[model samples]
Target: WKIEIFFRNLKQNLHIKSFLGTSQNAVEIQIWTALITILLLQYLKRIAKHPWCLSNLTASLRLNTFTKIDLFQWINEPFSPPPDEPEIA
Candidate 1:
């Protein structure tokens, strides 16, 4: 079968001795999953903070597919700039 051949080729190409161990493989899988999850969470947080600004800026620069207008206004409304402070005499 193709699956058997694929596994055999993978094992041979990688020069793996045996794929029976549990502890090392489990730890590696957990670490890789955690790293991927952390990266995705950070990305989502950035999107949440300034969806419109980031989307528009990145789109204008051709860095992303989303445009400023494409973002949800309710979620990406621009904050009002702080009022100017009165000058002290």
Candidate 2:
């Protein structure tokens, strides 16, 4: 039941209802983009082994946009840099 709340929160936070596409194709693109964004967020959360909700992860990424937080590292561990703080800092 709690997971239901997460999905609902994501749907609201993404403003999925504001998509004012006039054509079918435009609507499809909007839907797909939203889904893909959610998927990427989930993937990052899973890779990080994080127990927090999606909102937390999204906020963290947004805040760390300037930092060297590597999303690719979780997807590909070998060639990617370790999930650590930025080297420049």
Candidate 3:
């Protein structure tokens, strides 16, 4: 069920359904690209620990691709304050 949702989002966001490739190889490549993109987004979400929905994340990426904005919350790391310096024993 989760995968179905992922594929649906992929088609809607990445337009996989509109793939015009006549060859199996081309179609395979298109799907692979879409999957890789989704996987990257998922990883970003995981690391950032943001509660963003997958489809929404993809849309945000597309919408902000041209602008200089901080997406993914600190370059693939979750938001956290700097650790305290260790005390000398």
Candidate 4:
């Protein structure tokens, strides 16, 4: 079923094995966060020029999150050189 596959993707791709909180509100927030993350990644996958598997895309983003660069260009050409930084006056 589609729902089963969705949950499997969450577990495997998102690495959400156990809940961090026992309260209903906390659980809801965690699930919502994961859902939003999936949505964003899916959007990236669609827009990216280079063919990207979801897991690899996720890993790449995770590794590059802190690096300063043009996100749109990176999505299309990840291996290309980063954009130049403006010189501080």
lDDT of 2 by residue, 1-89 (tens): 87677457656656455557879999778767877898888777776644646676677566667865456553334235555555795
Write down the lDDT that model 2 would get: 0.65
Best-fitting candidate, scored by lDDT: 4
- Where model 3 places Cα greater than 4 Å from the true spot, the runs are 1-6, 74-89
Worst 10 residues of 3 by lDDT: 74-83
Q: lDDT at 25 for candidate 3?
A: 97
Give lDDT: candidate 2, residue 82.
Answer: 55
Model-by-model lDDT, in order? Answer: 0.47, 0.65, 0.70, 0.90
| Local accuracy of candidate 1 as per-residue lDDT tens digits, 1-89 | 97676446434433345554479887577546545644543454476555534334433334333433333332344444334567999
lDDT at position 27, candidate 3: 78
- TM-score of predicted model 4? 0.86
Candidate no. 1 TM-score: 0.32
The pairs that clash in candidate 2 are none
TM-score of each: 0.32, 0.56, 0.64, 0.86
When summed lDDT is taken over every stretch of 10 residues in candidate 1, the lowest stretch is 67-76
Candidate 3 lDDT, 1-89, residue by residue in tens? 98898778877767667777979998789878888897898887777655767667677677768855455543443245434567999
| CA RMSD of all predictions | 13.6, 6.7, 8.4, 1.6
